[model samples]
Target: MAIESVVVRQRVEDLDAAVPFYERLTGSTASRFAFAGVTLASVGPFLLFSGPDEAVRRVAGVAATLAVGDLDAAVEDAVAGGAEVVAPSAPTPNGHRAVLRHPHGGVYEYVGP
Candidate 1:
């Protein structure tokens, strides 16, 4: 079966602080979505957050993982966007992956096939 899409949700303490960094990493501006006092940023295949909610915080960890067409480019872009590489890009048990930390303590994983 074909996987249509994937989305990972993260809870944030402040939405505004998270947007620009994500926008830079994804190389696309976030499409904002709000409901029930929750704000979300749709960055390509992942959905990220910024707003207060205890339950969301408890459930959120390693917020999203992006499957990219080019690992090298993604890594370079992430670095240029001010993301700190938590894990350098390398082949994993599953595939190639690299971890990056956003300015606001959110984590993202970039994987390539």
Candidate 2:
């Protein structure tokens, strides 16, 4: 599967406070959305989130969010490359998602249309 993007994930206390600066820094307008009660904004290569601490912490371990051309193929490739599926594929507000952890202990969230 082709990797469409590697978006850095950041947790903010307030989306409104965080989005404007990220927009200026990334030079892209925010595309706001919500997932599992958390507020999210995609600005350039960054994905900013704000929500309850418990909800946000569940996804905080992910080093980055990968946008893939094909989620199933990406998951297969990752597993073949010594990665473990920490969270099985599931539908999110934006698309399907799966979380995986590599042998070296890096965690990533993969998302696709």
Candidate 3:
């Protein structure tokens, strides 16, 4: 597997407000998606969030995103390793991705380019 390392992710309290700020910062529009009552914005490989306090508390920071060539395979591996598919694989405005919660509570996004 070619693990290209973590790309980008940011934890925020309000996704509604955060997206606009990030859009301006990146000088690009956000590709938005809803997961776990939180909104996610993708600007290139950066996965930024604005959502529930609980979700933010759990992640507590920028959750690492692994850029995998095949998102399905990475998700399968995560599941086999006792990770739960917090967000199933799907096509977003940015690309394709799936969110997993590791057995130890760390959240990760396996993303495809």
Model 2, 1-113: lDDT tens per residue?
67888999999888999899999998999999988778899999989998898889876878999999999999999999899999999998788999999889999999996
Per-residue error (Å), model 3, residue 24: 14
Q: At residue 33, give the lDDT of candidate 3.
A: 79
Please give the CA lDDT of all the candidate structures: 0.69, 0.91, 0.74
Residue ranges of candidate 1 with Cα displaced over 4 Å: 1-60
How displaced is residue 92 in candidate 2, in Å? 1.5
Instruction: Choose the strongest candidate by lDDT.
Output: 2
Error of 1 at 81 (Å): 1.1
Root-mean-square deviation (CA) per prediction = 11.4, 1.3, 4.3
- RMSD score of candidate 2 (Å): 1.3
Reference-based TM-score of each model: 0.47, 0.91, 0.56
